[model samples]
Target: MRKVVGIFFLLFSLSGVTEVKDAHSASHTSVLLQSAYESVEPGRSFNIAFTITPKEGWYTYWENPGDSGAKNIFEWTVPEGVTVSAAAYEAPKRIPYTGLMTYGYKRPSTVLFTVDIMSNYTAKSLPISLEAEWLVCEEECIPQYGSFKLNIPVEKAIPNEAAADTIASFSTHQPEISWWDSRLIINDTSSALTIEMSEEEIKDYTEAYFFPKEDGVFTYSAPQTVVGMAEGLVLNAERSNSLNKPEQVTGILFLKTAKGDHQYFYLAPTLETPTIPKLSQMEDPIEMQSFPLWQALLFAFLGGALLNLMPCVFPVLSLKAFAFVSAGSLSKADRHKEGWAYTSGILASFLAIAVVLIALRSGGDALGWGFQLQEPRFVGLMVIILTLVAMSLAGIFNIQTGFEGAGQTLTQKSGAKGAFFTGVLATLVATPCTVPLMAPAIGYALTQDSITLTITLMMLGLGLASPFLLLSYSDTLASKMPRPGPWMEKVKQGLSFPMILTALWLATVYGDQTGQLVHLFAFVTFVAFLIWLREQMSSPLKRILILGVTLAFSAWFLGVSEKAPDRALSDQPSTSNVWTEQAVSNLRAEGKPVFVYFTADWCITCKVNEKVALQRTETEDMFKRNAIVVLKSDETAGFTPDTLKVLKKYGRAGIPLYLYYPKDGSEARLLPSVITIDILKEYIEGKGV
Candidate 1:
């Protein structure tokens, strides 16, 4: 008769009727609410337990459900002035499902909560309600929910031995605060948790696993490698690509003793500063030997020389060429002075940039080459400077230094000072273009000492200035130049078009960085007004004042522009097919050849490669023919640590990084910084690898 009545009550609860009961049963699971005390006492705290039992072969999730699954959620409805603490979960078991790992319980689990009663309570009875939800999973998942209600008399607390015993039985499953000192060391690719204990303390432990309370801390499916040391044990695991480097490593460490007993300990370990491993220590796919100092310096020089041919540098080079043309009539000694001055300017700029890069890196910033262009303010400033240079080149107005007597033209000056500033301009414009050997050289330099970095950058600057420097020294080469004529002015105006185009490109980059066009429009308008003021104002003092005010307003506008939203790529592909670590892994697992290219709006070489090779019809057809999955990692708005990790793994510090992963699970091959259509076809055809 009692069993029949319990069944009727279960059925009645399932019918959604509100009733004062201690248990609720669903199809796949059953939930029972039990309190340590039968009656509530004012101003006292008591514990309540929710025992969730899943049917055979089914399971429920813990707070962090590993790779995939939702944890149990509880919502309470109690009288005012009563407080309820958050539910505390038992240490979960590692449940392996196919290729994924999850954290949950296969059998019964108890979650405890503490309820505090107010001293001013005057009620005859205490009514408590709970809405509980959980996901039960086996081969498939089913979401289950239950509504439970209980009523207790508001009198002196009376201990319930049965309820206390039930709760005590599961107390062993709860994790105690860890006694061992633990520290977590994180790196670019992996993290290590080290627990300091005597060997005798862990002699009986056979295996260990950690379940982090935070999601995206480590790869859930990746195997945790345990290494035993004289001091203690260390568990090393792959770092998740989405890891944000939490302040503390909080988790539950589950240990299985040799006696088949499970011991759980709660850990909140201190996080040590992360250190990137030396390139020589990296595993396969990134297993290349470390770059020699000589090789790095040589590559920097060669790459810097090649940078002259990049599109972005062409405009600035043309200005230098015009200076050379005007210098043709000067004495050879004067020309030599100009050459040395230009070289000095290039060297100084390179050293200054390198110094800042080193300083920032020492301060724990993961910055790279051309990092300044990633700043919208810096990009906006470039746009303004370039626009001014373009106007000067177009002969819109000659910049008269009051010291130069107000009649001298900037181009015709061709003095050492003019050439020096021209060299500075060239270096500034050339930063975004990474020629063939520059990536590795820059990457290696960044990992080296300050002295090595400075020397390497100086070598690069020297190489960039070499061609003009040699030309200036050789009288024969200077004589080969055409004499100054009216056509020089035409050529100058034609060169202005490239400068304008470069400014437009930078403006586009600024827009992408800020996600707003209004600021850019206002800045451009200010530039136009400056041009008009220069043409209209005759007094030098008035022109200077107007230019200063306009510059101030432009700076203000840039400061107030809205920052771009963070763009995180989804695991699945969208219409644009942005790159994500998971997406690449999934594509490769499907036996498809994957092509990934890293780019940025500030990177001119990347844009040129896209226009000339990757975007070509033949390249598209080749990709389709090979069933290639193309993924793009664009770091225009800002650089992500994940993207930086991948770049550094391939021995690169900046973009135009291309990789081709074959369908046969072979090693991924790194492509060149600059790729042509034939090069893409050769790689896609498996001939280049």
Candidate 2:
């Protein structure tokens, strides 16, 4: 599919039927832009191209010219209506010319310049002169100048397909999204955009360019991109070493995707978050600290509705629907009653969760809506329930006699009970989804009185229950259900698939929270119990006995395991390199300048900065030459007390932290949350003595 899409666009480029005329050439070039000038209309822009056919050994500078280099600049001379603007530069690679460097194309190239027209005007042709200066070097730097006149008929409007496809093609080569790692994630709290690129793809590539779409979000020249991770060419880009989290980070990423003659743009990241802005007396920036009440309510409602579709909630919903349909021929009133009961169940559960969250918030428990699942016991309980569903479907256990099998029929009355239980199950599943979104809402609610918070929670509950309510009320929907028949038996059996799937999924969650080995043991034991339950039922009591034993074993496993510590190293990879207390202590003992990165895989911002700017050559060399002992500690899988103490020392509640220690080891200098190569170098070279 991707190949087909790429080819379709490639063909469009070949079909742009435009003619070219005047062609100029330099001493070292074979071909140049023939008729590259286009007239700009009032309030419109013209994307003019300057193509170069180099004779080899000649190149251009990217936006940044590195430590010592020059970038290509276009001196445009046009009518007042035509304002020349650089089409955001497709970043260039660093060409080390002698001891100096430059950023631009070395082979045949096209530089796109967007010219803006202030007002509408008419002309036979728009004439413009180009004074282009570039440092073309082989051994000695050669400064070159070009003077050319371009006269092209100005059409009333830019051609649609011709111009649209042209620009779109340029965009295809840009990075679509900026991410820290495999999963695409970008965040505002962090200062720099982190991007992880493949080593093979960037093997000959040596620079990172950030083209910001918004100002006030980031400061230019504060930092440069650096290489953080080296796993298969994975690297982290942080804000300059000095700045931590910027108010906002927004930009496009242009990395080297090919070698030699042909190279181009790969990604464009567009979205800027605000930093602390000066807004007189009444304006507060949008931070986790200052989420607005209306925004919170809106997010809560939307998030609540989305909760109905989460995988964890599906089983309960299925169980509910099965019960709802089984209620036999019901009067419209009874059906209405059942719908209200289900809604009540959902609302009650949400309110209960909200109460718990409020209490925990007061007690300072760091508790969120899904906080219960953080307890291994709760997760273990879910595992047992899933296992039971699986067993029942296979007809291995006589348990849950109300339902024939994992997906079997339920007695009409029992089915109604199932519907109620499902409501509860759904409430549990909805917690994780709601917490993150709710955090902002609740945090904002905290500024209001308790009544407002309660109302917010209520609104959230209403949204969550809306879908199930819709399913209940309409007779048409109920009638559309497959009539009670033998096929339900097969359908019931199919339900077991989801049950087993849930068990597996819950196991993964447990594993992530605890350890994989522990979950594996539980999975093995559950499977064994199922096997034993089959083929060994003598009487009802004996069957009950088997169930008891299974439950006891599961309970014992839960009892033996401790809730994984809050700071347990996370299963998710670190966004930055790991920094441990032991390593820091050792470094302090050795009197070496140490840079510590405390991060977790769960942190989206952490990952973004890692990929975009961290993984560059200059940053790597900076670390190496400075003898900067790099240490990292991840809290995703879990963290230890010592690590917690370290985190507290840095005054951070989460990951993606940077600390710089001087050789003298007075007090570690807390670097900004965002980082880059230049910042790291300055810290080490300027402060490390």
Q: How does candidate 2 score on lDDT?
A: 0.54
What is the RMSD, in Å, between candidate 2 and the native fold over all Cα? Answer: 17.3
What's the C-alpha lDDT at position 589 in model 2?
Answer: 84
- In model 2, what is the error at residue 324, expressed in angstroms? 4.6
Q: Model 2 compared with the native: what TM-score?
A: 0.43
Instruction: Give lDDT tens digits, candidate 2, residues 1-689.
Output: 54554344334323432333234444565334333333334566656666555557666545555433466666778875677776455444445331122345665555667666666656656666665655565534555455555555666554434344445544544444434343122233224343455544444454444444333323232233234233322222222222233343344454442242333334443333444221222232111112335666886776567667654467666766665555435556656665666677777887786677677657854432345655666766777776776666555555453444222444445444555556666776555442235444544454445566677777777777777677778888777765566666665666667778766766666766676546555565665575466447778877677767766776677786554554534754562345656667676788788877765433333444566546677777877887877776654444456655554433343345667776754346655445555556555664321
Runs with alpha carbons beyond 4 Å of true place in candidate 1 = 1-289, 400-414, 567-576
Stretches of model 2 off by over 4 angstroms after superposition? 1-295, 324-328, 398-413, 434-454, 516-555, 564-689
Q: Which candidate has the highest TM-score of all?
A: 1
Best by lDDT: 1
In candidate 1, clashing pairs total 0
lDDT of 1 by residue, 304-413 (tens): 89988889899888877777876776778878987888888898899888889888878998887788899888888888878877777677765542111111342334
The positional error of residue 565 in candidate 2, measured at the CA in angstroms, is 6.8
TM-score of each: 0.57, 0.43
